[model samples]
Target: MPPTIEMTTTWERTCEVADLEPGWGEVALLGTHQVALVRITDEEVYAVTHHDPHTGAPVMARGIVGSRGDRPTIASPLHKEVYDLGTGECFTDPGLALRTYRTRIVGGMIEVELDR
Candidate 1:
């Protein structure tokens, strides 16, 4: 079990690290907020608000994960908009991106850091 990382005020037990397969994604509800947690690599994971940056709809979790010139990204299934998995920066447009959250694993549990 890894040591827990204290971020913000409340601590959340989101998912188990083993439960998340690398290169795959998962959606979990933390409180009233729906979030998409994506595993981009063996040690890198991204937690983004499930709402789409373009439509404000919860669909980012269904987006496809891929890479563009070594930049890991997710292509929105709704509009095909590409977002950087690491930074949540949109690739198709200059100023479009989904809100990103901080994530860490503690005791094999995935924890998300959200602003309360």
Candidate 2:
């Protein structure tokens, strides 16, 4: 079975390091904030708000994972807006941008530092 991550104070422990799959995104709820976690590689992971800035729909988690040059990105499923996984910069529309949170792998577990 896929391992799960439970909420904790300060840094929220996300899914197990193995729970994150390469080339995919997963959504985790910490209180009311929805976080989209993307696994680019075994050593890399990124977290962003699941809310699509264009349509304001919480569907970024369902967005397609890809990259522009060397910049990892997630394409909004609702409007096809692409956002930078590292900086949350919207490439499709520079005017609209998403929020990015800090992430790390600790002790074989994925942890996200909630952006407050």
Candidate 3:
């Protein structure tokens, strides 16, 4: 058995549950970090570093969401680089990836897990 990793809630309620429609991405500031919270499907929500992994630009949150084969990904609006929403892994470079956060909806509010 492995040691259990504890997940702690980081972000406060940035937006109401109604504020996020299905299949959309929004930028929210959690502490000092900017995060891109995306609704991939009706049941799935993903949180990733808003900065574009390729250009070091803060614009992934505005990227369009789609799938490459079966992997749900977001295409950067600046350079069209695709990243896996779940893992924040660059589709072109596996070694290059974004930091991903745990996201959950509770009491009609959405929160992202933060590293303390």
Candidate 4:
């Protein structure tokens, strides 16, 4: 398990922490947007837009988790384009990107800063 990262900003509850399994990903609807949620570890969770930039398909939740050097990544299932989970930068194509969201666990629930 990784150390807890305390986020200072206010967070909106999205789902229960247990709703996502470690080492895997899930999709959650935030307002009208679809957010991809990943439980990378027992104490680490990441959220990003579920849309795959290359195909504009909501397929990121189905992406395979991986790493590029030290950076954690997820490859789009549709095109296999790799994207950094932390920055949403596409490693396969510099011109492409995904919207990253700040996520934190609070009271055993998953929360995210949707505006970020």
Candidate 5:
């Protein structure tokens, strides 16, 4: 039998919580990936890929922040594709999906867990 090895995930600190405005998305560079950081409230923040899956353009930071029912969503500025901020599920297109990252706040700073 082979020994089991455990993997640990590292969280990268992006910015201060005060740096993001509510209902707006900001772009943060994580290594070679561009992430769109959106703050829904003082304690709620979401991190998603800045690349638009439908258009293959990096314009997700300019997306409009809104809500569908109780779910927080962002609509692409280019094609108006709505995506769930928490799950990365696209509402406009069944074949398209957005990439989402895990986010957390610690000591007044925003941290994101990027999949490398």
Candidate 6:
């Protein structure tokens, strides 16, 4: 048997939970990657890639926040391509998908797990 390797998660502090308005998207720069931070409720926050896969534009911060059933979603501001905030699944187009990041709140600050 080979030696097991443990993966370490690096969480980057992005912003305060109060900084994000519910039902709106805000852009945060995590190193070289731009992330779209969305606040669905006071206790619920989500992070996704700001780059729109279909248009190749960094405009997801301006996307519309909505929901498909009980799953929270965000729609591209340019072409209206909807994506699942938690899974990064594109509902409108199966070929394209947005990237999602894990988010947590500590001391009222929002931290995102960088995709590595």
Cα lDDT of all candidates, in order? Answer: 0.83, 0.88, 0.80, 0.87, 0.95, 0.94
**C-alpha lDDT (0 to 100) for residue 24 of candidate 3:** 75
- Order of candidate numbers by lDDT, starting with the best: 5, 6, 2, 4, 1, 3
Maximum-lDDT candidate: 5
Question: Taking the tens digit of each residue's C-alpha lDDT, what string does model 5 give over 1-116?
Answer: 99988776779999999999999999999888899999999899999999999988999999999999999999999999999999999998988899999999999999999765
Compared with the true structure, the alpha-carbon lDDT of candidate 3 equals 0.80
Q: Give the candidate number with the greatest TM-score.
A: 5
- Across 1-116, the per-residue lDDT of candidate 6 in tens digits comes to 99998777789999889998999999999898899999999889999999999988999999999999999999999999999999999999999899999999999999999855
Displacement of residue 57 (Cα, Å) in model 2 is 0.7
Clashes of 1: 0
Candidate 5 Cα outliers beyond 4 Å, as residue runs: 1-8
Minimal lDDT window, size 10, model 6: 4-13
Tens-place lDDT per residue, model 3, 29-101, is 9888899888865457888899987788999888888888888888889878788888788887776787888
**Model 6, runs deviating above 4 Å:** 1-8
Error of 6 at 84 (Å): 0.6
So what's the TM-score on candidate 6? 0.91
TM-score of 4: 0.86
Error of 1 at 43 (Å): 2.2
In model 4, where do residues sit more than 4 Å from their true spots? 1-10
> Distance (Å) between predicted and true CA of 51, model 2?
0.7
Model 1, range 3-85, lDDT digits (tens) per residue? 98765556678878777877767899999889898986556778888898998888888889899998888888898999987
Name model 3 segments beyond 4 Å from true: 1-11
Global Cα lDDT for candidate 1: 0.83
